[model samples]
Structures are given as C-alpha cells and as structure tokens.
Target: MRPLIRPKMIVSAVLAALVLAGCASTPEPPPAPESTSAVEQWAALEATELIDQLEALPLDERPRDVLASVRQDEVVVSAADGSREVSVPIQDGHYLSIAPYLDRTHDCFFHSLTTCTGEMGNEELTVRIVDDRTGEVYVDETARANDNGFIGFWLPRDVAATVTVTGVGGTAEASVQTGAEDLTCLTSLQLT
Candidate 1:
C-alpha cells in the first residue's frame, strides 16, 4: 500500500529538476579558432588595409602641365605640377643650398621627396652630405632663408654625396654626383 505523493510535491520536484538543468548550462564551445596572435592579427589587418588603399588609388587625375620644371642649383626638374630651378650663392664648403615653395601660411623644410610644412614664419634649414661608401660625414651646415625662399650652400669636395634636409614635418634627401644635370629621380611616385 504505497501512499500517493501529493501533487504539490511532484510539481516542486519537476520544477527543481528543471531549475537544476537550467543551472547546468552547456559548456561554451571552445574559443573560436584564432588564425593569429593579437599582435599578428593587428599587423595582418593593417597590411590588408594598406593593400586595399593602394588598390583603390587613382593613377592619373591631375593635369600633366602642373609642374613644368623644378630646379636646384643650376639643376632643372620637370614635373606635371611645376618647375624648380636652383643655384648656389654661398657654396663655399660643407653646405648644400636649397629653396622651397609653399603657401603663405606654410613654410617649407628642405627634403628630396617632400618638403615639411611648418608655421607661417621662415625657418633655418640644415644640409648634410654623407659618403655612403666610407660612412663619413662630408657636408654639414645651416642655411639662411632668402627673399624668394631660396637657400644655398656648397657640397663637400667628396666624389659622391647624398644630401639630406630636415625640417618640421619630415626629412628628405637625395644622392647626386658632381656635375649631374637635370637629375630626375622618381619615375612614378603614386599610390596606385
């Protein structure tokens, strides 16, 4: 003669079991497969982003007659933007003179590839020529600003020299041989 259990007790037991099952949540799936470490992932993402940017860059947009020519110390450089011609006035020794063109509110710091932009006022520029073969410093001096925003100095008597200019934003340098004329370096400088 087993006694029948109360309906309330049965309901409570069922509820309790359900609560227990709910509490025992299924183990979370193993962390999703990570292809790389955090740093590596970041680097990969950056590279991919850069590649995408490069791919999206436009090759041709500006007019071809932008720079007719650019000159530096008896050197004339031709470009689609404009032209620049330069000459050395105080080319005594260890000094490479330069002139940069920029907007009224911006100053130009000497560089081979791009000029650094600074405040509205003019800035004193420094020039240096290094001998790559001997790892020796040949030319080093400070150049004063000219009325036309041009500066000048003399390269050391070294055989081959690399000139460098540093200013506010960045630095640019180019290598040239003595008496090299119409020195145009970059064939195509574009993101695309």
Candidate 2:
C-alpha cells in the first residue's frame, strides 16, 4: 500500500511555516524622539556652554565662575525620611538654624520569629556649603546638634549659596540668598 499523508501533519506544517514567515517578514520600528520642555531646552543650552567653556580652559586653570542664576527666598529641603520647604529671610549677618529629630520603627514577621528594627537620627550630621557664583566648596564639616535639637550656621551678607546636610537619617539640600544690608539673626531651617 502507498504511504498515506496525515491531514493533521499537513496542517501543523502549514501553521509552523506561517508563524516563521510572519516573524521573518516583520520590521522593527524606529526609536521615537525624546520630548523636552522649554525649561529643559534652555538648561541643555546652558550646560553645553558650560562644558565648552570648561574644555577651553587649561588643565591646571580652573573654569570661569558660574554666577548664581536662580534666587529664592525659600528652599526645599529633602531627605529619605521626608521633605519640607523652609523660608529664609533676606538679611545679612544672620544665623540659620536647622533642627532634625530621630525616629524609630520596628517590623516583626512570622509570629515574632523574624524581627527588624531601625532608627533614624539627625545627629552629628555632615554639612556642606557651596558658593554658587564661584563654584567653590565654602564649607564641609560636621554639624553637631545642640541640646535643643538645632544646628546653626552664620550667613554673610550679599552672598548666595547652596547648603547640603547629610546624616544617618537622610540628606537634605537648599539654596538661600543673604540680604545686602547687615542685620541680626532672622533665618532658620528645620529638617526631620
């Protein structure tokens, strides 16, 4: 008897061929262009100019000073735990205070078989200050909180700067502007 071809086998072969052909004939689409806002475009331009200026300078010679472009009466302080916006007064020769607290939490799993505990503290924080105009690191030191749970820094008149604080709890950053006229204490920053 002549060998018989099964209909199911023919159908399976045809299906397999169709799938392979479909995959082989498919073309990948081009990547989409990145969308950017007006602010982003301006920032990109500024960054490019900065890079070019730096590249032109000699290896040992530092780049030109970058003036503080943005001025604010307040700054947003952020940390891993939380964030807050603190207002700073435009006054010269004023002290800025920051207060942070410690919080504790515990987690238990599997009927108390597994336990995890953590503490967040804002003590002996590493604080840094940068001069925006000159691109210089003005201060980098550890700030110890007083008994009242506050850390203070003196600000010079007519200066704009960025401050960064880091501790076991988290980290925070802010930009501030000092008044042109010398004045007494007026500004404070609180982070928790």
lDDT of 1 by residue, 1-192 (tens): 999999999999999999999989897799888664322322233322422222222324212332212122322122333342222222222223344323333322222222212221255656576776676786687754433233444444434666676654456666655443423221111111
Off by over 4 Å in 1: 1-96, 100-122, 156-158, 180-192
RMSD in angstroms, candidate 1? 19.1
Worst 10 residues of 1 by lDDT: 183-192
- State each model's CA lDDT, in order: 0.40, 0.43
Q: How many collisions between residues are there in candidate 1?
A: 23
Candidate with top TM-score is 2
Give per-model TM-scores.
0.33, 0.36
Residue 29 lDDT (model 1): 90
- Output the TM-score of candidate 1: 0.33
User: What's the TM for model 2?
Assistant: 0.36
